[model samples]
Target: MTQKEPAGSVAAVAGDKSSLLTMDFREKSWIKVQKKDGSVIAEYIGKPGEQRQLEINEPVTIIVGFAPGVTMAFRGNPVDLAPNTVNSVARISLK
Candidate 1:
């Protein structure tokens, strides 16, 4: 059996700001945006700034295959990618 590599995770703190996620892809990259329930919202290898801003009423989880050229912010705050910078991939929970 082939085992998948473990992914890094970061949680978004509950705050007063609206549940808005802003994604700016500076390069072509693969990304999966989903709700916490595992329902996928968007998944694709998109061009720069392809998915500008997504408004989800609930929390979401995003798995980014390439982190360097992607910019993601939730609730007006930037999601920290430093924790998984070396891994080249990040699994973030915007909950």
Candidate 2:
């Protein structure tokens, strides 16, 4: 039987600052995205960020496999947050 990966809240930590105007972090979450046959296609860390500041250790819902982005509360609508040099870790859930 194929083993299914556990799904839950993943925490991403800030790695390094991208630029003077932008911040960046390293994805600490191990996310495996597959197509069919459970074959791993793309694997990356799913983290959320905004502007040039990412509220590290903050709990935010990261929607994966939709677009090259993340989700955030923007004016009562789900917005896609793209990865940028200024992008930083928004939240880190408690254990």
TM-score of each: 0.68, 0.22
Give each model's clash number: 0, 7
Task: Summarize candidate 1's per-residue lDDT along 1-95 as a digit string, tens digits.
Answer: 95443575333334434567778888877888897789999887868767676665566778888888788887677888768566788887765
Alpha carbon lDDT at 58, candidate 1: 60
**Highest lDDT, which number?**
1
Candidate 2, residues 1-95, lDDT tens digits: the string is 95443585333334422111122223333333343344544445545543223322222333234343443332222333444213333321111
TM-score: model 2 vs. ground truth: 0.22
Instruction: State the C-alpha lDDT per candidate.
Output: 0.74, 0.33
Least well predicted 10-residue stretch by lDDT in candidate 2: 16-25
Q: Which portions of model 1 miss their true places by more than 4 Å?
A: 1-17, 49-51
Candidate 1 residue pairs in backbone clash: none
